[model samples]
Target chain A: MADKPLILAVDHNRRNLELMSQFLGQEGYEIIAAASLEEFDQVLGKQADIKLALVDIAGFDRSVWERCERLRAENIPFIIISPRQSAAIQQAGLAHGARGVLVKPLAVKELLGLIRSLLGE
Target chain B: MSEKRLPTGIPGLDEVLQGGFIPGRAYLARGGPGTGKTTLGLHFLTAGAANGEKALFITLGEPEAMIRQNAERMGFDLSNVAFLDLSPTPEFFAQVETYDIFSPAEVEREPTTRKIVEQVEKLQPSRVFIDAMTQFRYLAADPFQYRKQVLSFLRFLVERGTTVLFTSEGSAEAPDADLQFLSDGVIDLEYAPEGRILAVTKFRGSDFLSGRHSMRLGERGMEVFPRLVPEVYRREFALEVISSGVPELDELLHGGLERGTITIITGPSGVGKTTLGLQFMKEAAGRGERSVVYTFEEGVETLVGRCEAINIPVHAMMERGTLEVVKVEPLRYTPDEFARLVRREVEEEGSHIVMIDSIAGYRLSLRGEDLVSHLHALCKYLSNMGVTTLLINEVEYITGEFRATEVGISYLADNIIFLRFLEMRGELHKAIGVLKKRLSDFEKTLREFQITRYGVKVGAPLTGLRGILSGTPELIE
Candidate 1:
């Protein structure tokens, strides 16, 4: 039997990370939750088998885009979660090699579909 | 004890509710902002706490500390009352984490429900007060769910032997009609042009006073003044006629005013209307009966001075504890409030004669209410209590077409004694006549009336003058 796919979820809000881990973990994925830049870097440095990532950029400053760039260099497909819909953040996500830019209050079905298609399931 | 009623801890409101609320039922106090809904809730819980019953105050709007401070200012002792403070804390805003995957109704309702149930089960309070029950509307998924949850919540309290009083902050966007239907009774408080009014719109198992009653929120807290219902109060008294101290004036009345009848002293300004009412009070004082004069138009000192000058001996009557002169500030009281004062005088102090000095001043106090109806209710209440009532009406026209009474309130009077400025022998003089006496016959002829320094004087019937009713008499034969 093959092990489940591993998904990295990053958000400043503890509750939002808890919600994501509970929801996506039920979908046959093992989730690694991080609440700060240090935790995100530590997980990405050692874990090269990461399948996908969901990054909520609410409390993080401008340095969060560099994390998105690092995910791109590591050949990991990821989605950026913006608190509001703005052309600047969408363009930044595109520049940083994000597969999609989802707004805060991500639609549950839409998020699941995006992850499944990225993982080829 | 299980079938006893609950006092609402408000003065005069229990009487309006006809001996307080029935136990083990939910009631709604519906009103807008600043209408004393929260104060009323505090009154309920405090009253229960005073009786050594467990009382719970579930505040959903104001925090418990602020509520306690306010209640302390109003002299409410809340030591025994338990408070379930469900109001939002400052940390709710200071926290950086926010979640929207699930709606607030889904995320918060279960925990809040658990908290309330735990508190109630732990305290076992017999009295419960929920401030702003409409706050639950946000916790329910929809209006249907809200209604179902509130109904069950209230039933849960009632099944546990708790009498509940909840308040709803009704607005145009969200009215509390559903809550009104859910509760066993509804008390509505509102602000009208006259003053703050409280009305019991619905009571399921009890009979309540059903009208707009006057309510005041003052420094001491809320006080309700029930509308006077004449038919509810009655006493069996003799129908004997009383005598005026002046013999000729009593002859004009055929004897004097009846014991329980209302007499209207209608006249022009300065035509001795108040003086005649005072004369009757003097006679009642001589008989050792107490009299009260609600002088809306005159100062107490001025009335005492004028009565003493005309030999009515108001000072002596007051000294003897048989007379009371109340100077009423018209704008300071609503008509219902004034009626309460008069009720205390007649029913509590045993006053036999009650006089409202002038109708116009009383009308001014009404401040756009239905003057005739309020006056009728007051007079009927006084009459039913077997007390003599004198209503002084000042007509605007001094010497016109001879109207019996102005302001269209003559029908409320059982006896009409009108005074006029008559032109007799090219001299302006006062004449008195009885237009109608409901209980007995009165003299048909007018009499020469005068107010001398000594006392009120009346001459024999002037049959020699015809057309005296016209305000200008002509001698015949």
Candidate 2:
């Protein structure tokens, strides 16, 4: 698990954060969890080899998009986790260079497959 | 099999189907832009929604927002519809599709199928409409893969009892050839210089009206007028003589117009052909039989006004709901569409009298159809339905060497009522003559005709004159 690719998870809800961390951790990926944009920035500041990011863009603010932009600048692929199955939400995520937009509570199999492809597994 | 059918919520279309589309099967609507394909699909889904059935509209062409706006404008409420909008908006038009074309499997096929399947599974809709199914043609450049995806999608939907309708913008050469075999039926709409036409090219298990029928778009949306097949509508009618409301005109018509017969009033313009037809229409209304007037050259208000001035009581008859006036825009209607209007009034609304104000206006609109033959067939159908028909034809020259009509519809007309404008003694005069009446004898003498404030007044025969039938009269010494 420790040798697995480091994946960052950003979400405002603590339960969703814990669930994602546990699920991805059990799937043999090293996980870093953040509850806010400030915490996400702090995590990115300390990490040098973050492989992929999963950001919950539900009720997302300007800072959330800025974080996506930052990840885009770093050549790090990311996925948008939204509570809506709306085209507008998916389009907004795609506009920001997100690899994919999946609705929650996540399609676990599809999400894992997406993570594997994004990480070049 | 008529197991179950998905009703396409367009007026007169189901009648063409003899029922409706088969349930759990896929049908394709093929047409070009401005052919009302998208509008028809919306009607299908909205109708399903109205029936308490879940419905979905997956648009791959126009933005769903624009579609919604258009549907609303057409008086369709789509609040109950679930949409899978994969189309890009104007703001996102410039985004490059980095859909990994190098490996077609992962990029296009999975997303397109998965998106649709996921949405359908979520909504569990009974009816689905896929707009611009041809977009998939571009997505999968490899024809084999495109066919495979579409076939599988159809199979999957049918298995789940999800009846489907998809629209395509097939080119003129072979618009629906690519995926036609995969569909259970194909309803083809064509917009040509001649007119808009629709046909059911193929249907797997059900019978449908096959030949190209005329289609038109109006305030009520798309309506298909199945070709007036006369044989199917032939029936016997009571040979009762109906009054023309004008006592003198009725006397000339041998106690009035006969049921299930065609009477054409031929003359140049402004010779009271329309008013003559209106008199017969007013007579039908008085007897409590419904009548419909297809006013191609005149407005309803103007026709009604003309009738009221002559004490025809057109307004009272209209307000009584015994008569209907359909003012037609010549360029906007086809002969078949006009036929459908007449059929609807007769069959559905129980109209007993059918009148076309002037054939010249009808000819201009539906000129693609051979004019005389089309009118012949339409009149035959009306007569078969036990309805009295009056067609007014305008001659080209008001006072030329006498001709029966410009188009020579004499043989087709069961009765020829000839009205003419003459230069009698340097004074403009009009004459009405019965050229032929198939069912009975008519007055052979020409009558001096006048349009009065109280209506048409006809005088005794002008026995002292000759050559009046040739536009110039001479006294016989």
Candidate 3:
């Protein structure tokens, strides 16, 4: 797992996003942190080898979801991180072909496993 | 009674339930920690889901992911089932909600109950399992409130045509009878000397086997064996003759041992008790009837080799599936498990002859001291199945005085064959005689027996002998 691929994580909370980034970084993934779609776009420009994205998808606007569609078209996979996980969220997540949706306050071990599996590590 | 029943999926449990659980009723499976209560609940949901019915597992203690992982390991696919995670998730703890009006239990249970009601209304699942039902009990401040809430929930589920199975960890704090009274049936699992035992304490409208069934909980989940009550399995078997491989020995018993009877062969060690049983099993194989020899003392290889040395085709018979030698691990097999194994061999494999090599060795495998009683029941069961069984009992004394067997199991047997070592002119000799054969005239004369590479040799009667019953007979002048 040397020369790990970069993963971009987008969250509304700075501390939560940084904590997840640090935890995954220790697990050998190079994490790029982003707070919004603007920052995610900036990170995408800088990092050519972004393996996957973990983004929050629990707002009224369709901007985050449309970005997810664009990512899917670019052959990049993403998993949604929502504050609330329900059957509707899961269905929406499946329709978008997002890897899966993780509820907020994530179990660190489960998050790590999901990241590792998606990264093919 | 005829009613709409659902199978429990666990082997032998349906038989104990006398058909299966009455559907659309709530059942409680109560057990201590690690006693397989959760697994049993999952089995019910899985069985329902497999039958194209929607199922729901509402976990109150463990997370849905952990439950799904454990269920998958046991070969249960829960894809069709929905999960209502009532346990406090990370967000539940993080969210700050003011709860000044409700008590501690109500603070937790209100939202959980609302979620369950919503899920049931939406999914309309036919089966629902509520794990750690005791958690709700703990939430309620008093016993009466807890009982009322549970009864209401059970009634709600049953009214919607949902068959429910709830699990409770039997603890000292919470009373199990509270749940037992509310549920339509109660399956109580407990740790016993032999293994875990599952018993149905109550079934509201149906009659179930009112005894503890031996249960095993492993990766494949629970397996229960209803207690082997011999009287229930009895049937009428014909009085046909089944011979031993040795021709002369068969002559001593008129024709041979009658079918559906237990034949006890008592002898000292190294006096050919096991070999004689093998001879009968070999003959059973030759007659195209299958046989199973459960040797509690020796290994299968040694038994096969010894039988092969006597020109007996133990290996060949096994190769053709006519004979099977099963070595019962010492102190491992319970009488319940052993009886089930024999029943499977006879009922499933169609084996006609059953043999337990030595009673003493078999006793070492039993948990309780009532080895004779167990043997009596098992022999009766085998006889009723029309399976002829042979038991070898090794005695303590070799000569001077003869007792048929040390275990006092002789009376339970329909026929008794006594083998002894006799010293004649400073040379040791083997003798075989039939002491008792119920309703059959068997010759009482002692015959000289020998174990050679060519198999058991039964010679003519030792005619010039007196006081033979004393084990030390003198030749007449």
Candidate 4:
């Protein structure tokens, strides 16, 4: 059997985090949840083999950008998630080194497809 | 009696206050953290500076650099504004001692307020902002003495024609009601579970907006929004027919939704309330008009997927900035925060149509606590903005009388469109009716509806039905 991809989802909204975790978990992915940048750092320190991350832009602070920049330097892939799907925000996310931007209440199938493409699945 | 006015420079705010703040008078801005008090003070002074008036911002607790950084993020160029930082020093202590002549121990403990006043005097600014007054409370052992000192400092500013905006951290019961009373005006910022709300607790000698209004701190600064009043709304805007996105439903609504008015779509569980709301959003977005959907029940992706099934292309509209979808669980937010989020979409995105998918979900998420007032405030706020608001309300069952829970929302709404499941010939059928529309004449008929791949379609009316409200109607065969 193929190894389960470790997916990290960061969001301050607990309900959203839980929903995303459940949805992704049902699809054979190991979901790691981080509520804030502080918790995200702790998770990153412990879980060294995270294949991808879906960071909620609403919960994102300035620190998240710096962390994403560091992740880019280390060749780790991350996607920006937001309820707002404005072109300006999408462009800004791309400029910040995000592989893609997922507009929220995400399409599970589309998100999965994007993740698979990014992971070369 | 003519009063001096201080312009906040925020367009709507200036208009609401009949030009601006009472000139040469001190105002107290009190709120907890993230309440936009600091932002308002900054905007006040920065706005003054923009108008060629010298403004000074004195920092007592936070570092000057931190304030500058925050301002930069909000797009406030504070370079022209004077910054006086009084962190720790004998001079700060001496100023504290002078201000705390009534309470020496308080002065010896925290000297920020006194130093703030000294800086104000030195700068001789046309406008002044004391970042906060919370730190000063610790200086006084007695609350009475603290109030006295605050009054003295405010008097000093008023005497010099320096319009001062003093920010403090606390709710109404913040042990500084006396101080608030002493100020010429008191602007209270509150973070409710729904959204960020700002209230003018007291604006002396002026007919200011009295009740709490929704506001948000955005790229421009503090944007003060006016509350919606349905009675006034009926006076200003004309009502036009709006499509329910279902052809049958459109016929039921007498050719469509009443335009430039409020519409309430009330239904029971699994009655396709959200689907109906989404259809309206889709139609509005399709027309190239901006529409925003706030769903407490569905996620943005789920909503998008549903839209895709209905062939609505919501993501394309969102990318074009013509459509915005926000999923807000009431449990995850206060009333004030929710209002702020709505304000951001309305102001920043210029959304003309807004849909709240099921107020029942919002009520359930909030656990039915003070939601009615919040809704009332929100409805009033949206109506005043002339934004056509569609509020989806979920009823437990269609049998009960058509009345809003406690908040009396039906009375507050400019229009009410009731959705229900009526059983015809022992088979369940969707039905809709226009209960009330304030301005326009709408057909009073219970029309049948169907949920199809395209969206809701309003079929012909169910003839020969008296107990339609009971959900069991005998249709003419």
Candidate 5:
């Protein structure tokens, strides 16, 4: 197992994806990025070390859920990132086996705390 | 397809959507700056919260704090709505570039789409609003890649049963036709120089009432007015003229005023336009005719005082339950709300006659590109209801040969009465003329008039005014 937690981030917006990746990358964790579900699937197939995936809920559709479900079945923990923090969404995320929900314009420190709690860091 | 829709709570907007936004279907709102797109989106989200649906707003270009401040300024409560900031970073761009095996530079430039999907799965909001989508344009150099990323993001949202409204700054250069075409619905907002009017260019999958309508951003978010179509205009039929409360003036109108027809009492400023409107209301009330006066130019106190001076006894009518007065400061009400209010009064009060103190006041209050269309819709609505309507319009130069130059309004009036200031021998005198009366045959000749403590009195026509046709009248020697 990798000593540092492995995180995969997916988003269509380059700026957001970059920001989240950099924020998480500097905190002594390995970060991977994918622009689409197809690319994300390919990355998962190639790299099995990713322990957590951060997904942007805005403008995302069902294939994303399918992929997340597959990851959950494999016992890999995932966190849902969204601009909206509605109770319904949070509940849905939790029910879908995500460890927790992270509302965006993300705070690096808060996200780190959540990851540590989920991974026993 | 089986997903639920979120109601926007805007009067006409929900109707346009055939109820509300399609539940779980993402939509695109495209516009240029000052188009009220953001305000509209915010209104939808806030209204959703009020309706017991949770809303989440994600800001890409602007700071979350600034978004909250602006929402408050627009009178929207964001306390119930969630805010998230997920701005892109550089290393994320590098990771996305690694996947672009074709171009190393592209790999370094594009952002990851997987991260965004992860966030959506986590938040699982019922409704989502992305402040803007322009930020993604730089992620992929090729349009194909950009489309793929956008499609993937949208698909993720739809699968989770999330209704999303994405705003994009429409650019004249390299318009995003592909993005617009991909969305379930598109609303184009435009701002024009004339009258500073905002108009909705088009809305797909709906029976959109065509024509430029007016919109304004005021203390109450964005208000839209759907303009009238040409098919609703009709010829006036001869009906009973109800008294305007001023006994003698009612005689000048050949009775009271025609019922179920538009009677336009136009004049220059300070010619008792509002006073005449109030008088009509008082008369209608005295006869047990339910009536309401919506005034844009005067305050409630001013209207009451002016009626008191004329001894019309407006307060007595109000007390008797036959009259209702609504004094509107144009800035406070949106055109849509104003129209809705009129509909309510007509329905609830069973008002026989409706009076707008001055059309100019209405115009100034709901300043939008579709001024004519808005008036058309208002007139059509009232006329179709068979409600006798009186509209007062103030003209700057009322002295000209009776002509209506303002666009899209002259044809709307069943009767046009011109009140002018006639200059004779270095003295200014008021005059009244029936320029056009659709139902009744009247004297077309211009006649002199006087305003006294008693009210308006008609006199003989000025025989030798050569330049009256030009609006600059010259007195006969």
Candidate 6:
């Protein structure tokens, strides 16, 4: 289990975080879920085994970009999930070194394929 | 083998269906809100329950408690009916966090399907009613998947020998055309300016009545009135004439109006057209035959009083069960509903003579529908039943132009007995004559007509007068 690739999932919604854990867990990947900024920072402190991240940027302040910058410096590949898509949001997400920006209501197949490719599995 | 039918708990609806729904098949009741779709489903389930069959109501849009309460008030006994309450609860809103990530089709469909399958296996109900099957559309990721799921779900129930009746609340944005196509039968409910109409457009494996029948949603729940088809009802009768109990009047009509034929007693207002119809009924009453007068323009008491003043003895006739005067309020009933009332009188009460007080009042009751077609169907139906029908047609014009019937419905009349207001010798007088008689030859002469406290009096043919139809007559030398 320790040798299994680990992923960090952050969302303000507990049910969405649990759904991601259950879906990705069935694919043989370990998950670390955080429902708030405080929990996200605590998981980030001990995130040495974290292979990738999926951050849903809803219900967060502007300080969330700082965390994204910190993830980039740590050389972690992550995807940003937004409630809506726009050119400004896409440009901002890319400037923050996100691997991809996905809108909310993500398709399960697309989300799984992106996670597999990001983990190089 | 003859197909087994399950009555829909509505007798009129069963008649429209020719028997009832085909057993072990799925039917879709499609309509907008407040069109009685759910109420129709309740009738289906309760009907099965009454027959000692296990019935299940799967409520998705409305709570089961509310449905049971409503059905109870409508005199429906839901004691033996089982309910599968799949409607959303307070917990659904409390757990709003589950709305995203996985689609509802992925997260919710499994448990919903499991619950339905488990309940069905345990109870094994013979009838299933889904309040609104459109709720399943939310449990599907796409339209194609929704169609497939619905097809399989219906198949599963039908294979178990369960007759399914489902409702769909369709909208302009999301029409249930696909579900309609998949259904073995489709009953569409619509609200029109006249009244609520229900039509069965598609019925597989059997035939159904093919027009928009009238429906009513009242305290007793939904009631359907099938359209009257004249060719379907017939009775053999002799080609005999009925007398008007008057010597001169019967002479003008050759004998009198023929049995099983339609007569139009047309005249201006207050020209005693209705009294003339009552004259024939008075004679029938002396013979112990029943007559029903559907008075659309006058109250029952008013008409009865007028007839009594003319020595018709309508009160005695009603007391003896030989006459009934029905007051049909305007805009109160659809044409089909009025036809049903007449049918009850003729078919059940054994009425020999049926009279509609006036044609214009009947047209007014129709709201805005075509008067001629409705009257034609009713008259044809009455004719087929071998019942003498008298229509009191009040033309708009009291005089001047020579017209037999102003409403342009003389073609519907088997005998046209027209009364005219003529000016003779600078005095306003009434003249009665026969314009057309389809069955026999009528006297080609106009006679003086008068209504008195004694009764109707007809004089000899006024051969000395000409231009009687022009409302101004001249003496012939």
lDDT of 2 at B206: 78
Residue B107 lDDT in candidate 3? 41
lDDT of 2 by residue, B1-477 (tens): 427667888756786777788888899998878888987898899889999999999998788889888888878889999999988666544543321112333334556788988998888889999998888876664678788878888888889999999988888764558778889888888888878888888888878876878887766567778877776796677999888766777777788778998988898889888888877877778779888888877889888887888888888888998889988886776677777777768888988888887777778765476877788888889889888899888888888787887776778788899899877788898989898899999888888888888877887777778888788887687
Which regions of candidate 1 deviate over 4 angstroms? A1-9, A18-32, A44-121, B1-3
Interface RMSD of 4: 25.7
Candidate 6: tens digits of C-alpha lDDT, residues B1-477? 276789999989999998999999999999989999988988898899989999999998799899889999998899999999999998978875664766778878988999999989999999999888999999999999999999999999999999999999899999999999999999999998788999999999989999999999998989998988999999888788889999999999989989999999898888889988999999999999999999888999888888889899999999999999999887888888888999999989999999998888888876538767988999999999999999998878888887777678888989888888989878988989999899899999999999999999998998988777778989988
- For lDDT, candidate 4 versus 6, the one ahead is 6
lDDT (tens digit, per residue) of candidate 5 on B1-477: 253456775666664454667777778878788787788889888988887777788777777877788889878888888876656445646764322112322333333455555566676778888878766766665779778877877888888888888989879786878778778877667775543243434445444455445566677887665443424444344556666554445445666557778878788787666666666676667678788888886788777777777666778888887878888875665565577678778767778888887777788876444566677778778887778888888777656655553544878899877777766677777766676778777665666765555654556655666776565677667
Query: Model 2: chain B TM-score vs. truth?
Result: 0.83
Q: Candidate 1 clashing pairs?
A: none
Q: How many backbone clashes does candidate 3 have?
A: 0
Candidate 3 lDDT, tens digit per residue, B113-210?
A: 88989999999999899998888876676888888889888889999998899988877865677788888899999997667888999998888888
Which candidate number has the best DockQ? Answer: 6
Interface RMSD of each: 3.0, 13.9, 12.2, 25.7, 11.7, 1.8
Model 4 vs. true fold: TM:
0.57
Q: Is candidate 1 or candidate 4 better by DockQ?
A: 1
| Model 4, span A1-121: residue lDDT tens | 7889999888877756766776678778999999888888888778888999888868466677877776677677999886676997788778889999877555556788998999898
For model 6, state the Cα shift of residue B343 in Å: 1.0
Residue-level lDDT of model 6, residues A52-117, one tens digit each, is: 989998889888888899889888999999888778778888899999999978888799899989
- lDDT accuracy of residue B193 in candidate 4: 59
What's each prediction's TM-score?
Answer: 0.86, 0.70, 0.78, 0.57, 0.60, 0.88
Query: How does model 6 score by TM-score?
Result: 0.88
Ranking by DockQ: 6, 1, 2, 5, 3, 4
Residue B117 of model 5 has an lDDT of 59
Q: List the residue pairs that clash in candidate 2.
A: B170-B175
Alpha-carbon error at B290 in model 6, in Å? 1.0
